[model samples]
Target: MSFSNFLSGLKEKTNELKDEVLKFKNKNFLHAATAGSALIAMADGSIDSAEKQKMLKLIENNDALKVFKTSDVISSFTEFLNNFDFDKDVGESKACEALNRIKDNNVEARTVMRLILAIAASDGVFDQDEKIVAIKIAKELGLNPADFEL
Candidate 1:
């Protein structure tokens, strides 16, 4: 193969590697946000269509999360939901595990809390159950629930 051709192939491979690294770096944030969304959605014992739609829109619009393909976000959210459906305690444990991944990062934790609050209120009523779940999430993140008005 010509040197030029080899260089071109190397560049292409490098670009692909960079893309994969970027995805990996953002994967935790994506999972955490989606897991929190699932928790808030299921807080009231029923996931509302409006809440689902709001989460989709948020994923599309949020700069940090928009880097991820929608399919990945949806899949993560679905997995959380399925866990909840299969067993409430297991689901919550899994979701909390994901959330705790970024707990030490104040900025990311606050962002996740905001997304959770938005999802909880999307149904037009941030009910007591939702509030309690949000508060729990806030505490798990080492954040003050009152800071989020939870």
Candidate 2:
């Protein structure tokens, strides 16, 4: 192939790789937000409508969540919310994995924590249980709780 054609092909491949990386990152953020919301919801044994609304709003406003359709995003979130079982360590594991991905991206880590804090305080009061779990998740993700002002 000619040099110009090879360069064009290389640029096309690079663009394709960049697009794929972006998609992967966006999915990672969505999963983290979903799992974090679930953790907050289960903190008090039942997730109230207020907390649910707050979380939904956060997801809606997040650019990463835009990659998913409204229904798809909500479904993922609701599944996590319903399946969250603090009694089992599985929920924590899933949430922590998501959190780690968020933290690895730096900016998303702070954004995710801010969303968590908003949900935790949505009832006008942050419960002890929520605070404890949020702190634990933050620690596991190697995030500073101070960043979220928790």
Candidate 3:
């Protein structure tokens, strides 16, 4: 191949690799966000329509999450909810595991915490049960619950 063609191919390959890496990172974020949302939404023993709508709105407004389709986001959220429906203990364990993935990154952890808090208060009343779950999620993300006023 000519030098120009070789450079063009290399550039294309680099862009493809970059896109893959970005998608992987976003997927991790998506899982963590949805897991936190599910935990908070179910904390009070039920996931209300208000809570679901709040989460959907948050994802729609968040630049990082907006890259994903609404259906994809809903699917992820539903998957977490399904896990909880199957078994509370197992669901919590899996959700915490997902949150732990970003614990080392303080920024992402804080953002996730913020998202959790928003979901908790989405129904106009952040009750004790939701607070307790928020605290657990904060600890899982390596954040202090006190920082979030939980």
Listed per model in order, the count of residue pairs whose N, CA or C atoms clash below 3 Å is: 0, 0, 0
RMSD of 3: 2.6
lDDT tens string, model 1, 1-150?
999999999999999898888889878889899999999999989897899999989887888787789999999999999999999999999999999999988998999999999888887889889999999999988899999876
Clashes of 1: 0
lDDT of each: 0.91, 0.77, 0.91
Of the pair 1 and 2, which is ahead by TM-score? 1
Instruction: Name the TM-score of candidate 1.
Output: 0.89
Candidate 2: misplaced stretches above 4 Å? 1-23, 85-87
Clashes of 2: 0
What lDDT tens digits, residue by residue, belong to model 2 across residues 1-150?
999999999999999898777766688787788788888777877888898888888788877666566776687787675456434467667677777776777677767777788888888988789988888767755788776666
Candidate 2 to truth, TM? 0.76
lDDT of candidate model 3 versus the reference: 0.91
Candidates sorted by lDDT, best first: 1, 3, 2
Q: Lowest-scoring 10 consecutive residues by lDDT in candidate 2?
A: 79-88
